[model samples]
Target: MTVRRPAAALASLAVTALALTACGTDQQAAPGEDKIKVVASTSVWASVVQAVGGDGVEVEPIIKDPSADPHSYESSPQDAAKVTDADLVVLNGGGYDEFMTQILGSSGQGKPTVEAVEDEHEGEPAAHEEHGEPAGHDHAVNEHVWYDLPVVQQVADQVATELGELRPAEAAQFNQSADRFEQEVSGLQGRVGEIAAANQGKQVIVTEPVAHYLVEAAKLQDITPPSFVNAIEAETDPSAAAVAEVQNVVNARQIVAVIYNPQTESPVTRNVRAAAEQNRIPVVEMTETLPTDKTYVQWMDAQITALQSALSQNR
Candidate 1:
């Protein structure tokens, strides 16, 4: 279930952020807090920042809940205050966390802001209004860049670059950390590619597009109906016709597995999962945010392993 925060709450947060910005700007770094302060929009991005920043930076993520939908997140006063005082703000800025952007803008802080989506996928295909699907979905641009391993590497590089520019004294350390992170991410890509090669052209259905990039990275075919995906993403019940179409695909066992998100729950999505199970199709759960116990790389590795196991059963 998704909770909708009141507009007044957000307005209050904006006000708090602005006030904090004014107070924080003129003050010197505190005695024990000399490290560079970095704020991220989500835990997934925060983990990357911690990896690249190592001991030289303090990273804070505003949206830390595993179950909250990042797309519809509301900022709290504490989140506003964090962004206001940050030296650098990192966000998945393909229209994903506009609340973060709004807070940063309203704070009037001159901190450096790095947007992962725009920075990582330079010269890539232009995003459709909702880029991650079978076809036309009138939602915002897809901002789930963290699922794409290649893009994650680029975002890490961008983070290192921005941090180096912010504190050039620690430039070498940042670059070194980034190199180590890149190697780990590359390993993940290799594993995913291997799975993709083994399951070439395999068809799958998703409750939503949370893992669309990952599915595509594995070179699997997404046979989900666009209407079904769009409806789930828009937080509405899929129309009767749209629901039936997806049920037909699953009932026929035309796909190898069904990918569902345990974090973002909806009645419609639950129904889809039940149908997939009834048809004896495997169900793989993917998360949009990092789990509290797992690091970014570990989270991706587990999901990839689960997907590989599911696809392997099709043989």
Candidate 2:
């Protein structure tokens, strides 16, 4: 999605970034700066970097608000300044946060950058394919890759490698931290597997495809109509027929649960939720960013548990 930023705002940010550059505040650790400065596009990735960097890094996320829509996020001068001053930058590429690209492009800095979905943009196959998922899984069409646990693990390892390159003395520590984090992620994956074993082939629906990877991992079928999904993702209203079809499915309780994204709620999505509630079908919220005071793992664990509970209740 193309994120529209005011040209005047971008120009002002560019000028401010240039001024900061002229002040010799390069992308390097200054005297008495003990931690590496890492900037991420969202708090989800920021939390991952923090886990891997442990006490050796200071991570800042531009879009930390859980309610904010990352697809349409606007960039500010302060955000540009953060990217310019960051020793390393991490972003979920694949057009999810184009604002980060705009800021980085204008900075003209050659600092190292890590893109979680870099493989997708580089013409490489999707991460799901690499992990032996079914060939039919359209991971490339779903940019919300953070829902993919294996991809998250890979991003953690990449973060460790990038941090190690900056501080060789702590390279081993970073790798070890990443390993520990991956172990925890594995535990979460195990829970997902249990859900799959119990609820395989069960039908579910989503207002948006934000949790596509997670649903796929659970072996649950997403019966959301394609036209409805396309319209919602494109920020348009679904046709009356499409909306009625989804509502009918919910009213019939054909799906076990409705995976709703409250962060991107619209009248249509809310209507779907209402129909699900009226039918006593479970509605589980899946957000794009971390909730307040929750770590990435904690947030994901809660979501998985919620999904399992919803499915179990249906059973």
Candidate 3:
């Protein structure tokens, strides 16, 4: 599949690599440089590569916390330096990490970039619209496809393919990692299904669209507050009317829990959690970005359990 790059992608990287020729006379390499150096756009993507890479790779992630939004990222010269040096780069593709692309675009990061969301599953069904693009070159679709399992499976397959080729010596390890990742995806699909079918059609609310795919997978009905979703896109506080609308949704609907995106914090969440408590509804704190120590499957399983508890509350 063709990985979309800005018009200047190849030109920038080509120029930079040429400039490097003027800076240093000796060809010095990074210490322990035998491993494949891959750049993952997010912490979640980084963790998956780490899982699949094991000893064969050294994966560096650009955004590492639950508190930062990739939508409004500030890329520095240092970030460009990292991308320029990468052997392979992975991005969420539906335009989620524009900063990543921008850094690479300018720094001359000609290293092969795998579009995690769009490259792998161009035709398969996905849990969300972020899955694939039209057969042509349009890139205006939803970009947060990593929230779905099929999209993630596609991501793993693409990542492994790149790793296998870049580090042919680690081919076996990369293949094994891909196989294990695929199995984990299947297992996650089953577990998510079990949780969703158990509380099928149960009402839920979210601070962001992070868990939209899983909510779809688990069959939880989302009564997402328009204010929260909108405010998030604008990076501002919600209006009083929006807040009132959210409170009304929680109180009127038997909303089992509010799946708050840890990455996207809001005073709205705090107030809504209190409101949910007053209404005797539960709150389930969720993360779109993975923790430093979690495997992808563990993170996903915990989320399923959290959703189940929220949905089954006071039922």
lDDT leader: 2
- The C-alpha TM-scores of every prediction are 0.84, 0.86, 0.81
Best-to-worst order by TM-score is 2, 1, 3
Cα lDDT of model 2 overall? Answer: 0.81
Candidate 2 worst ten-residue window by lDDT: 1-10
lDDT for model 3 comes to 0.68
Best by TM-score: 2
**In order, what is each prediction's RMSD in angstroms?**
7.9, 7.6, 7.1
Q: Which ten residues in a row have the lowest lDDT in candidate 1?
A: 1-10
Q: Which structure is stronger by lDDT: 1 or 3?
A: 1
lDDT (10s digit) by residue, model 1, range 80-129: 98888887788887667878868976883456665665422233223322
lDDT of 2 by residue, 239-270 (tens): 99989999889988899999999988899999
List where candidate 1 sits over 4 angstroms from the true fold. 1-33, 119-141
Please report how far candidate 3 places residue 21 from its true position, in Å.
Answer: 27
